[model samples]
Target: MFSRAGSSAFRCCRALPPAVFRVSQPVQYRALSSAAADAAAAAAASPRHPARPTFFRRALSFTGGALLFTSLGLIMVLGPAYESAAAILSSPSDAESLSLFTPPDEDAQAKEDFINSHPLTLSLRSDPDFIESRPHMKIPPSWRKHNLTGGTLMGPGKVAVPPFSWSEKSGKNFVQITHVGTDLCGHMGIIHGGFLATMLDEGLARCCFPVLPFNIGMTAKLEINYKAPAMANQYLVLRATTIKVEGRKAWVEGHIETLPTEEGQEPVVLATASALYISPKQASVSIRR
Candidate 1:
């Protein structure tokens, strides 16, 4: 019975063991994981290229360079034009004839006409005679002046005499000057204020005679009252008179008149002035060449 039981147990055990069992364990995913790691490494090792510059950036650089070049070119080409425009804008209406656009011959003709109309001439050529003839007249010592020996104060076709006079009673210092012009007026036939001032200054300076010895005489005080405008190409007279003297100071008076702006038109009082002349002692130092 024991043997039989043992045999049965063995049989049972064998039978149970004999039951075929397949151990189907999950397959290890090593290959897949290795493939993934390889892909990641490959992605990390690849070099990344930088992006190209945008169109705007390249265009901006080009535009900036072009603008700089263009500005420089314009300045070089148009600088003269700009200056001419400025001059034309600021000049007086009467100055149109003197413009660059005017013909040279026309300008010369206009100038001649103006000069012929306004003639400044005196009968007496002697400065001393002129001064002495005026009774009780006081002349400044600085009046003994001379023209620049060879220098040209008179323009072309103009004549100027040296500051000299020959009269028994007249002093040795005096100057005689003359100028002629025609149509001393603008296109509208008006005498320019600048011309009047210029005439007065010339007359006064001539009356002062020698600008040497006393090279110092500033237009310290000038008061001009314009009584009338001499028509273009009219004879104008400028007479400078020295009324008083105090040390280096002097009082000078002047008048301007038109010969025939209208019939029987007495020479009008165009302008007057009072000047203070520096003394020769004070002016000598500055006058030396």
Candidate 2:
């Protein structure tokens, strides 16, 4: 009976102490609290990269901008169905019609001034031989009317002179001709240099024309040295001298000079020329038109 009492007492003591034990008021969660504190500290530190701009900030800022309609433009130009984005660029000119001022009387005055100033014209009044000078009888009007050029005969100008005048002294052959620059303008007021060159070429051949057998010659090569401007409407003087006549080739030297405006003033040298004229073959001389 004593042993049974002792066992009962031990069991009752264990059950009573377990019932008396209680959980303390809930302990704060360390994991959740530490995470929250770390997050707050990080927010307070300086940022490495700036945050993305908000829509409100973009709307308020009027700074340098991106092309907002960029996607729409790309869709229009590089689309499934192409649409050309090139702008039409064109303009009309009214420059000719809207000219502000009229040009001077360049043609008439130039012609008159050139003629009146020519020294050859003054000589014509004093020297009868100069006045008597005329084209050689050998050079027919048909030849002049069918004057030779690159390969064709040039027609008469708007104004024409009477005929070429020829005279000679020593070995030099002199030819006088007058031309109105208004009729042969390379530019508006200037006489064509090519026309002057053609005249010089003719002077070269005509210097030795009287000595040729067939009365026909063709220029092989001609070089000109331009010295001064040849004005329009001037009575120019061209003098050529035969340097030598070697069988079929005739070498000639010539000069073209402008008429001086005043007495004792040297004539303005316009150009110097040298040429080689060769007798044409009989076959080349036959008339073709």
Candidate 3:
């Protein structure tokens, strides 16, 4: 029985399946770690982008951009304006005469008769202190070509006769009577304000030129106030009074008005102005020793 039992135990042990024993295998952890280290080194050696700009650098860039755009916009806006201004200021051309619409000879004659017979003209002629010479008429021929008022603006229908003027011998006051043609209108039937301003400048300058150092002066400043629209193709009067005079500078005020149709009638005020004139300094001579 013991033998049988021992044999039975042996058979049972043989019949049981073989037990599985787990064997430890070495892992490639070191290799994986080396590959990770190499990747880190490669990443560290690669170049990187720079940091953000400072506040001052950013502000400067913004300012430069703004100025560039602003200059371009100003050029677009001011370029045409400058051209128009230059055209107006330049001397009138021969083609500009068409704008005058010259009147018929008979009508021009009649107009001349009326102005010559005007009471204002007669009175100015009678004044001894006042000389009735045409302003700028006697300028050198070279300058006449470039003169706007005296050269180009003079004609039969236009400034009918040399402007009639009366002046005080003391250089304290001045008067000018002239006819402006219809062609010089800024708006229909209304004379241009710029034309009136030109007249005022000339009249006021004449009023103070005598008091200046060399009897000549340049306009320094002019301020004008328009009170009413001056009608075109009408006789107008410009009167100026000298306010004060210094060594080389003079101040004067003036006004433009219509010539009354009848004696003792009130003339309409068109515009008024005040101006400062400054005479150029005398040239200095240098003596070379």
| Candidate 2 TM-score, C-alpha based | 0.47
TM-score of each: 0.39, 0.47, 0.59
Pairing residues by index, what is the TM-score of model 3?
0.59
Of 2 and 3, the candidate ranking higher by lDDT: 3
- List the pairs of residues colliding in candidate 3: none
List model 1 lDDT by residue over 73-151, tens digit each. Answer: 9999898667655553453331222222221355445543543343322334322244322110112112212232212
Candidate 2 global lDDT: 0.59
Worst 10 residues of 1 by lDDT: 132-141
lDDT of 2 by residue, 149-245 (tens): 4113222343333323454533246566555435577877677788789778877787776555554578899999888777775657777788888
Report the lDDT of model 2 for residue 195. 76
RMSD of 3: 14.0
Candidate 2: residue pairs that collide: 181-233
Off by over 4 Å in 3: 1-104, 282-289
Best model per TM-score? 3
The Cα local distance difference test for each model comes to: 0.48, 0.59, 0.78
